[model samples]
Target: MTGCKVVAIGGSAGSIPVVAELLQALPANFQFTVIIILHRLKNVSSSMDTILAGKRSGIMIAEPDDKEVIEGNRVYLAPQNYHLLIEADKTISLDYSEPVHYSRPSIDVTFESVAQAYADKAVAVLLSGANPDGADGLLAIVSQGGMAIVQDPATAEYPAMPQAAIDRNRDVVILTPETIASFLHTLND
Candidate 1:
């Protein structure tokens, strides 16, 4: 999948550390676009974009803006208090809405949009999270012929997200933090 269109990674609560480890494993000029949808507080400001940017060498990290173009080598996070949906053209849609799984920037919404936007050219990965929000969406991606991966539920600090994906889908890669990074590096290769 050298020409894969996008890689969508999602997480929550325990996302900070998992995301850091994952980003460190990818090359700076990674071949595919990386979009992240981590649960965030609606009222509080998130430093995730800046923080991920600082930790990763070549991955440009920023919050998604409405109609913004998606590009490779950059990581886009859904902003707080909004659903970050995507267009068929790979542009972004940021909508302020009620929370799902009690999260404003819900992972399922992002995955669902990407499943539609990128179709078979997408990859969806779910990490540690406190809720099962991304499970259904991850399955949607798989149904659309996209690859789906989940962190090992047993190893995840919070396993709801990973476990949910497991229950909903089969043959999903379940990996540890370090191994997850290595796998991503290999996949992006």
Candidate 2:
């Protein structure tokens, strides 16, 4: 994981529990910046950052502002109704473009930007989702020589999302939530 500087996680339905589990498993000082894009309602207020910031994880979690610098060992959540993009200079930019696939904060939008920004130094994970939103983005990451990980459909609460990614990306690593957590914990070793 020497060259991998970012870990991009995208999910929809049934993703919160898995994300929490992964966060709990990851060491506080995990080297890569963790960017999360979870499909959320457009107008609803959110406390996702606080909810994910349990004592065990001890990681700083926040919703990123436009043009905010990306820092390692922190977790950034995509704000509702806005798409998140990573800049070449390791900063984040928020966009209010029309929704893709009927959703803003689209996983595909964030994943593709991260692939371009980090190239081979990025890892993208597609977790449980009801809709097939993250497939193309995960493929984009793989196409850019980045690693792709998909939740095992059998273990997913909703399999459509992970299954879509597996269908599109031949090199995706499929793992259960627990296994995925353990694998991620080794990134900085």
Candidate 3:
């Protein structure tokens, strides 16, 4: 309760396997509320929680509700048709607003929210994604003094998102999924 506030992760398509490997690489007590931003259809309901819950334990996982407190030791997933924003008070706010970069639950929005809230204590991560959606947001995290990490383009199944972030911001940490997950384990320890 007295450390970094959040870990915001973005991914899509081939990200499932990568995320699984990252989760497996991490130790059980890896703290912070892990927020996952995925490309989801607005009209279709998704059970990402149920899908990922099959993998591991020691952390609760669910779709985030508007104004819900982001607790440590939980995974808050962005629901379909909503942009998940982290408020200044460390709670989540769901907005059914228009899409940014054609994404309903934009990764950019989530990263910006975390950047504004926790700054240097926040960690914004970009994984395998097709478009350039998370590029600006990753830059925002660095601008706000938060840690910015992206999956290595060579390792990422879809490299555009990570490549875009790197092209936009040179200082970002572009690493493999395993390395990023390991880095999280060392934070605040």
Top candidate on TM-score is: 2
> Candidates sorted by lDDT, descending order?
2, 1, 3
Candidate 3, residues 48-127, lDDT tens digits: the string is: 77777767665577997788988887888899888999889988999988999899889999899889988887888888
Residue 132's lDDT in candidate 3? 92
- After TM-score superposition, the amount by which residue 23's alpha carbon in candidate 2 deviates from its true location, in angstroms, is 0.5
Candidate 1: deviation at residue 146, Å?
A: 0.6
Model 2 residue 102 lDDT score: 86
Top-down TM-score ranking: 2, 1, 3
Worst 10 residues of 3 by lDDT: 18-27
Per-prediction TM-score: 0.94, 0.96, 0.93
Residue 132 alpha-carbon offset, candidate 3, angstroms: 0.3
Cα lDDT, all candidates: 0.84, 0.90, 0.82
Please provide, for model 2 over 74-121, each residue's C-alpha lDDT reduced to its tens digit, 9 standing for 90 to 100.
899998899999988989999999998888999999999999999999
